[model samples]
Target: MRFVETRWDGYGFFLDPSAYLAELPRLRGVLPPGAWAFVSEPGHYDIPRADRCVKDLELAGIHPATDKSGRLVLEFAPNRFKHESGLRISYTGVRHLSIDYEHSIDWMAVDTVLLDEILPDEDGGCVHEIALTDARITVRCRDLEAVWGGGC
Candidate 1:
């Protein structure tokens, strides 16, 4: 439900649990729903869906750090990810546009991680986001690109 600023149009935020929800409505105006064609009562689906791809990849669920913090972040791995859990979408005739991933990492593998210097200048932390457009698609990933910090 939270949003982070990023370098994409219309969509760009690390960890958009509802990104798919928005995408379905946006695309519905342009094309027919996917689920309706294959099966009846196609309650949910989405083409070029973001939520389906980013639901989980195991980002600490919480970073517990901020820009003011100066302490190093602890390294830890996630037990599961959204991809493994499966994403739910809304649509009838949905077709995959493309799922491009910039990075896929487990920053927890490295100790002494810092946020201010480690995370991206915008929307940094262990958070990541996926972007989908009618003409182009992008997935903003950074496995080891960012670091988290905890105030001492």
Candidate 2:
């Protein structure tokens, strides 16, 4: 799917890890164990979806952005999981992945580096920018939307 690194101002959605918020129901934690993130645009290389080279990234940490425009950057922790075609697309730009979208376990892609392959050029920030845009992200951890506030 897609990694939605958004940019917002004046009372953004995710800031504090609060359970009362409309988003982050899971307090304290950054994201869930399994999250599906990516974009609709193809990668820069000829990386097929059924390649064994794909490496899934984890939402490791969340912190402020170095850019003046961007206020934060959520680090994809570090892990890898394989994926297949059983995912259910709930809506546009959204996918429900029962399996973690970490790597091309079932040879889903040429290389799991697909997320890094496609991204809007940016120095990194916390303004609610589409970190991973136009792609379908499977986020099992609801906290992702709360911590990052991803949208289609």
By lDDT, the best candidate is: 2
Compared with the true structure, what per-residue lDDT tens digits does model 1 show for residues 1-152? 12322233333323222443444343332322222121112221221332223222222322323443322222223224312232222211111223344332333342211101011213321222233221113122222222212111
- The residue ranges of model 2 lying beyond 4 angstroms of the native Cα positions read 1-54, 65-69, 80-152
- Model 2, 41-120: lDDT tens per residue? 12211223432222243333334434443223344422234422111112211212222332223423321122321222
Best of the candidates, TM-score: 1
For candidate 2, give the lDDT: 0.25
TM-score of 2: 0.20
* Model 1 lDDT on a 0 to 1 scale: 0.24
RMSD (CA, Å), each prediction? 17.7, 17.9
How do all models score by TM-score? 0.21, 0.20
Write down the worst ten-residue block by lDDT for model 1.
112-121
